[model samples]
Target: MTDENNKIRVLLVDDHPLVLDGIRSRLEDDPEIAIVGEAGNGEEALQIATQRKPDIVLMDINMPVLNGIEAAEKFAELLPDIRLLMLTMHDSREYITKVLKAGAKGYILKDVSSSEMLIAIKAVYQGKTYYSSGVTDILVNESSKKEVPLTDREKTILQLLAEGNSNKHVARELDISVRTVETHRRNIKRKLEVKTSAGLVKYAIENGIVEL
Candidate 1:
């Protein structure tokens, strides 16, 4: 849908300068794509996006100040027609699911070939979804498993535990008894099939319930 004067505008967001350079180099010469702007973090991304209002945003998941998932939520609210395409190193089901829920239209790995990356960009710009092989594999694998849903309380406790909060700290924050927190923790372990606190923390981080 590129006329001689009109092209698809894209904003690139990533914490690393080298990664931004690589993406810029890949898409700079394209006839139908315009490199409108770039941001090093999600907070900067929001500012640039609000000012530039690009048609698509290629963003990384992990960034300082603000994560891409949270930024994607704001982007959805600020720019309804803007397409959010995730370009990240994370290939877990949790990250993908969270990004999609946060209003991302596509997810692709950072290691993909330039051709595949371009294809993903074009697809998402054209109102379609795209996912890298690694992302699709994680989704398929998770779908094949017997997924266990966590309750709201368990999720809260898990997030607190992952953030290095003690039982007493969690109890105080939630206004619940320490014994109740312990019970939730035990139940979380049993439901998640994790034996130790470390395992619980790892699970929580990997599943997008909490960040490292």
Candidate 2:
């Protein structure tokens, strides 16, 4: 049923052993996918991925040692050819955007059917991005937004905020006055139509405003 030469080698990374086991069992039924390795945390995942060089990795968002986003960033830097797919229970836009920015090629909810999972794996392995139906609304809403350009300074300041830096801290780090940082923050909020700092951070992370 599977073309051995065309098979996609997959690595599963989740802190929960039961979830990993379920995913492995479901995917094992498909001849086109081969479970090459498994890891319980992001650090272990990095080690396993480096050793196995899997064609695709199914990464979970929340882990103990290292989060999925961090691991994805490292993997992208170290193994650019390896496709990363986020497999998580969270359907939040903030989480989705973070993973995408970290270099994940696909995002699928844990409740996805076995068939859908297989298709997503195949799609990401072929270099196409995929999102589950549950989170498709977020993508659609984001796509409908009108583009608003930002200045270089504003962009830099926004990136710092996205990385969880406070306004005062960002000002100090950027060698600018606190008033200047506040001004830039207001300008960024106006441009993005985001009323709060949290909203701005979410937008920045989702849009890949700052390199992880």
Candidate 3:
């Protein structure tokens, strides 16, 4: 009763029953956190959140009935007081961008240690923005590259390169010839003022084009 009032109420959202179970196992015993409710999809999350009115919602990025991003928007609209923290396997810069722009207070990878998860939840519950270490690195890299001028094709080739994809792979993926890939690489290097492949990779990361 009094203890429940003292704890941070959390609503768990995920599609897989096993995942919800796993999260429950990790968080159920924490004195600082209370598992107020569980929802299998975004719509369910909203319904439960309305009823439960949790302090923070720990949500997954992917789900069948409604994706986490869309649900995040809804949460912003209908439950503006409830903070959102995303737990997911995706570490893509694109996903991070969308989720942050959609109003998630924090984003942590699914593989983080339980302690880290608790840290994220409490941080958001306290009104601070939290991001997984990898996501943080991506964001830091982006700010440095914000001044770099890159074309769409050039950025695509650089991304594949940073991923350690050989020119052949980039060629096939882009449906362009290997020679064309080489040409684009040369152009990117020239534009970025880099002299080597290692330099290209460094620039790619600095430009926020690489996925963590």
Candidate 4:
């Protein structure tokens, strides 16, 4: 716990300057939460986290030098005590699943209300997991029965596809051949009963693989 005078320190990590300003503005009013530092990318976030040891880290997912999921895994290994809350426009199942597996304490969309964002931050700081309404709905949907039980690899491909990744991009990320990626894509479509990429994306959204 923070000292009586010391508020819960928070580190904001995002690539957009406007977003950083907006989030800082929304959070600065709360006396209980202190905006300790700001970082533009995951690398910077990790550096600031190491130096500041803030109570909560508001992290963005897609970044230039290092993506949020990769950095989050590193942070989990390096700073096990720190709390990480994803604050990004992306609400994909792959994004959520990877980050949570990397040890994030909460997942919230960038569009969330300031009130809900604050609640998520507080919950994570208190060592509890919190997900925004849309994210929670995804988790619930994932737990229920499904017609197509996708393999782990197929789900990964579907997630990348839903995130707007091309076959080449997915292959590179997973360190697989383009031919292998195409094969998996075909298999995924066949199993899910979706023919087009657009249809796959729609299925991903409707079935909680990605958020609309």
Task: Assess each prediction's global lDDT (C-alpha) against the native.
Answer: 0.82, 0.81, 0.84, 0.81
Per-model TM-score on C-alpha atoms: 0.66, 0.68, 0.68, 0.66
Candidate 3 clashes between residue pairs 3 or more apart in a chain or in different chains: none
lDDT of 4 by residue, 6-41 (tens): 788999999999999999998988878899899999
- Relative to the true structure, candidate 3 reaches a TM of 0.68
For model 3, what is the alpha-carbon lDDT of residue 10? 95
RMSD for all candidates, in order, please: 12.7, 11.0, 14.5, 12.1
Rank by TM-score (best first): 3, 2, 4, 1
TM-score of 4: 0.66
Candidate 2 segments exceeding 4 Å error:
1-5, 142-144, 148-212
Clashing pairs in 1: none
- Reference-based lDDT, residue 64, model 1: 91
lDDT of 2 by residue, 1-212 (tens): 57655679999999999998999999997878888899998899889988988999998999998999999889878888899899999988778877766767778999999999998999878665667877665654564443538888888888887665767889899999999999898888888887644456456645657433
Error of 1 at 188 (Å): 30
For each of the candidates, give the backbone clash count.
0, 0, 0, 0
